[model samples]
Target: MCKQSGTPLQDDLFLEETPTSSVTEKVAKPGPAVELKGSVFTLPVLRLKRSDLGAIEEALSERISQSKKFFENAPVVLDLEHLETPAEVLDFAALCSLLRTLQLVPVGVRQGSAEQQLAAVEAGLAVLRGGSVQETVAAESKDKKTGEVVKQVVVPSKALVIDQPVRSGQQIYAQGGDLIVLAPVNAGAEVIADGNIHIYAPLRGRALAGVLGDASARIIVQSMEAELVSIAGHYQIFEERLPDELFGKSAQVYLQEMALTLVPLR
Candidate 1:
């Protein structure tokens, strides 16, 4: 037998007793299809000290030769603010092509001149924030009495706290903030921060603080067995076993006159 329209089924109660609006109200709504939020990641930055393409290519090749697997296919951001005003405009497309041919992905650029910015966009690269030179954006405001326009820059602060172990191949980055780890950072892991990194357990992999050139940033480890440590782009790699006294001991890493320095915490 068929039920008539507007009639409830034998096993249903809401459709018979509840009004349409009330029945609909009792049903759950569908969740949103997407969400938006802020996030950060640590990435390699290539600070351009010169505009010569030949030199840049040669240097990149040499650097990658020393650590091919480490840099292979990794996304690198070009820092253009450090580049001097060139006699000629940079060829961003060609440069990006070169990077691709060398197995490196050129994804974005930062701190570029207006011309460079346009060129980079044309070359399919994004303009990312947090460049070593893109630390601030100036907002112009007129002084009330003087009627003079003034530029103001503001910086935000934050901190990332992790309560569990950082396993191998895991990367933790605290962009524009500090990173605090309550557990061990195992081999092949990396921890980076723009401000500072505090590890309450052993650091067996890499710890790079002041990643965006904050020279005063530091790394404090409860037990240091790091394969590599860096501060403000200055780095040290332990090719051999660490000295017995320094291994498995508390230590702090910082920059001294632009050089990476590590010392005992006690």
Candidate 2:
């Protein structure tokens, strides 16, 4: 008769097997990778002059009522530099609350002093510095024979081209220039340009042009089926299907008189 034991015996030698260590397969966790890259973004700067909460709220309410669509969920930077005095007391928390009431999200505070910055932090706001606000200048040249220097006029950045389709959750932004997508922009994707946006294929996602407050920015799409279109700070959403003649056809979007205008791209 075989002896009974708590551990199993080895099949070949018929000897009791020693305890073995457990092995596990390594798995990669699903999370966003940490990467450092250069980027540029446009933010509406609300220049505040007075700390009067009542007046500010009233004024903001009036403005919002006029064009609630444009300001909906808009992120704005508080510019305290325009205040009468740098040391002037400001209730940042109250001001932020007032802005939220008007559908404007206050993301950061710019041009504030030490005290004001501290106040902004307490209000859960970021302190941002002035970004590059100037246009790109071309290379200067000098006349070899005349020994005279010639300055060339500044030119906007060259257009960025995307040859592949923009998948959902993908974002492409052209800073200080135009963006041209040769492939379709799937729904839930975003494409932004500071100058203009040109889509050679269907545009079913959101497209924002003139992100840096360029009023002349325009959007041209081969297929007019965008979920949302925006120029400068003006925006228009397409809740329903586009017109039969306009859908899946060439169209252009622009801003006129601080309003978004869409027309056929002829």
Candidate 3:
């Protein structure tokens, strides 16, 4: 009743298929983990000539008037490089006063002679080129050493402070220790800290913490809802819209388990 199909060959000639798991195992594996890095903020330098104090003030005032929105709370570095004249001719205090009027904080002086450096130091402003001074001091100490005794020189860490509110378009930076802000940071403002950023008032602007690659650094703000928050180069932008509940609230931002988290401050 059944049409005889072709004679069935009994000898086996079939080859088994290779397992897919073996192919997957032969593929390259992932490389080592990567460490995230942070960013640092440097103030803009404003240079002036030795005999151009009046012009310096005028130019600075004009700049402030034109970009007042931009330099509201920005810190500035006064470059006295062109002011190579005698220290007696320079009115450091008056210059500082002028800067204060423009809402620019002059933290340090750069490119000055030894006498200028001395005056700056006496005026409570840190000397920018203190590295050479420190190195020379260290070398002298080594030369004075006679026996196997080595002098241990410890340079105490200095703290920088900002006692004013940070407005929009302004920026504040701390080089070493913690950065303490006693005022509110408005939108568009930027605050950077090498160690930690502690904002005593509301912070609606950008705040960067753990600058200089400090993963352990943290940002503490009285009020959150920041335009942008960054830590160790990782950043988050609230462009579309910030949560309504987060507005006008105290919060803390930090890196936890390689992720950025914003938590309400208790």
Candidate 4:
């Protein structure tokens, strides 16, 4: 009962043919273009010597309060090498949870026993090996009853040498090792190391040494025109123009009494 709706057919002379190639070109698909790559990076490690959680939480809270800027949301590698026994069972889930409550993210665990490794894996933590920082413990006894204290000496890794200039927008980090740059570091570049940093040529960018609380770390430069320089967490920014004596001069920067000190390189 409904009336039919339709367009009138056009005359053969009035009809125009359209090219199919143009339509195909518009709808054509491109080939797959995804690739995988690998790179190296640096991360700080937190060594654990005991399994007690309450004491650890209290101590960690105090430490975090002291250095809020560095501890907040920090990624850490958990080292279990300093424990009295490798076979000692630990509550990996509880440990990770406590760390997270303190804003410490645990990415991996190192130097643990087979069972401990499995527990960490079950807690969604990776097992790490042969990294720049390893087997280094700087933690106190977490056992409330035993009240035992342990100390560990960290042996720094070999120096990382760079023979070419570091261009702008480039970042170089020498984890647990000294960084030696034989060429200049251009502006907008960054050089960081956990031990020490040495530049044989002009340094116009930023240089940070002792990134992991190594107050003994130092920075030596042949021609120091750096925009910023830091030793451990102590830093000094050159807001105004650098002094003639300090700029383009051989200098050595170090930490003294928790302050940054710059002196002539002798």
Candidate 5:
């Protein structure tokens, strides 16, 4: 007998071999990458007087009611340019309370007096100086002049139709397109368009046309009781206010040498 040292070499090799299972091989297919485009909307500032808390609240409420969609998830700058009084002279807490009541999230302030800036900082609001505002405006204007084609295109049209009452605290925007309102635009409501804006009903709110530098844009209203009107970036607050003859009647608003003009719509 061959020397059996308690192990059988070749014969027992089969028992010690590890088992393997067959797996089907599959290849993964490659897909194309997705591209995203940027937004085309621009937000405006809410300018108010320091002592006119009631007016501010009312205006904000009207804005909210007019265009809830636009205001959602939007950033805003409060332009305190109209406030001539020192911030120390006004009640910061009261102002905050009024803002809250109007459902306006005040993130920052611009064009405020020195005392106003301090008050804003104390109220935990960012203060954007006039220089900064001018820089931003200039940059935007430069971008427009460059005429760099954006991924998103805005088509211009002559006619539009809106069949709802625009309430205070609401805003409607039709950049690069005409806007037609078949209902009333209540006080505090804002209507903005880069093209013409036509309201067939009472316009007791704010109207801003040619927002994106379209100097030829115009505004036509069947009934004009507007608190403010703007065209081609130039604005007019009816401090003396438009005459009653202009209100409850047809009117047309336009820009003349960058100035705002309202005339009877014959």
Candidate 6:
């Protein structure tokens, strides 16, 4: 029997067995060898603050022990902003192997210096670009040769919308934009967006916003009963139940001082 397993939307794969070939049967024509599409995903980022592999292993073990299921086989991106200056020496292969042994998948590295990026590529990781916060400003610039004033504009994608209730096991994503749901989000479902997530109905599942590192993104819900919620990778899980003051009430989830903050929407 063929075995297939993965998350609902991110990596779900379908397979089927091929029938026995026979001369009497019509000749089978070959199909495309592979297909590719562009998609946006929200993955956890592991920022490296130090270059000590021993210390990193110890701290990583402790942190993963606290949330085993959440980190199991989860893809992650390395934040190498700290490794730029002084060019800290890093063992990409060793670090990646360690992450794998801990049941984590290191898919890519972002914001790395030239040498670090080369090292990551040698270690079979993608060199990604969008891990830093972005700013939208109407600023003036001068042409290099002519010294002429020029204007630059930043355009943002429109928010993706769902007009009906999101069922369990369903995953919705709003790439480069916000997300809006007109109905309830059932448990076991997930809604993700690169910007804010606005729900006109109750939220009972997981909602991840600001997946691209927008710290100002927020999740606004009509009724808040979410099992988990995250903004800019800072997350809060409701193990048992929410406090009486916030359970099933209109609420807003945002990031404050690099921490996840929840407040009533009164």
Report backbone clashes per prediction. Answer: 0, 0, 0, 0, 14, 0
Q: Write the per-residue lDDT of candidate 5 for residues 1-266, one digit (tens) a residue.
A: 76434434686443344556698678987776876885444445676665777876777778776656545545666777667554534565677767666655667777767887787788888886431311112222224777775443344555557799989988888744789999999998888876789998999998887776577789999988887787766666664557877967899988787677888977
Off by over 4 Å in 1: 1-37, 86-88, 132-161, 169-177, 233-245, 264-266
TM-score per candidate, chains pooled? 0.69, 0.62, 0.42, 0.55, 0.45, 0.79
Report lDDT per candidate: 0.82, 0.84, 0.70, 0.82, 0.72, 0.87
In the range 179-203, model 2's lDDT, one tens digit per residue, is: 9999999998999988899999999
The TM-score of predicted model 1 comes to 0.69
Q: What is candidate 1's CA lDDT for residue 130?
A: 59
| Runs with alpha carbons beyond 4 Å of true place in candidate 3 | 1-156
- Candidate 6: give the clashing pairs: none
Write model 6 residue lDDT over 1-266, tens digit each, in one string: 97565334445554545667776867889999999987666688898888777888899999887778888999999998865353875789999998899899999998867888899999999999766765544678998999999887767699899998999988899988899999999998899988999999999999999877788899999999998899988897776789998999999999989989999988
Residue-wise C-alpha lDDT for candidate 4, range 1-266, written one tens digit per residue:
95434443553233344446654345668876986786554456676777789988988898778657657898988888877666897898999899998999999998888888888999999998755333345655445677666554566799999999999989999987899999999988989998899999999998988876678889999999997898865677665667887889999999989889999876
Which tens-of-lDDT digit does each residue in 79-196 have in candidate 3?
Answer: 6666656454466788888788778888888777778777777777877652111221222234355655466654424656788888887888876667888888888889887667
Model 1 Cα lDDT, one tens digit per residue, 1-266: 97645555575533445454644346788999999997665567888888788899999999888767778898988988667764335888889888888899988988767788888898889988654532434588999999999888756477899999999989988877899999999999989888889999999999998877778888999999998888877777775678887799999998888777889887
Best by TM-score: 6
Q: Tell me the lDDT of model 6 at 95.
A: 95
Better of 1 and 5 by TM-score: 1
The TM-score between candidate 2 and the true structure equals 0.62
Instruction: Enumerate residue pairs that collide in model 3.
Output: none
For candidate 1, the per-residue lDDT at 20 reads 48
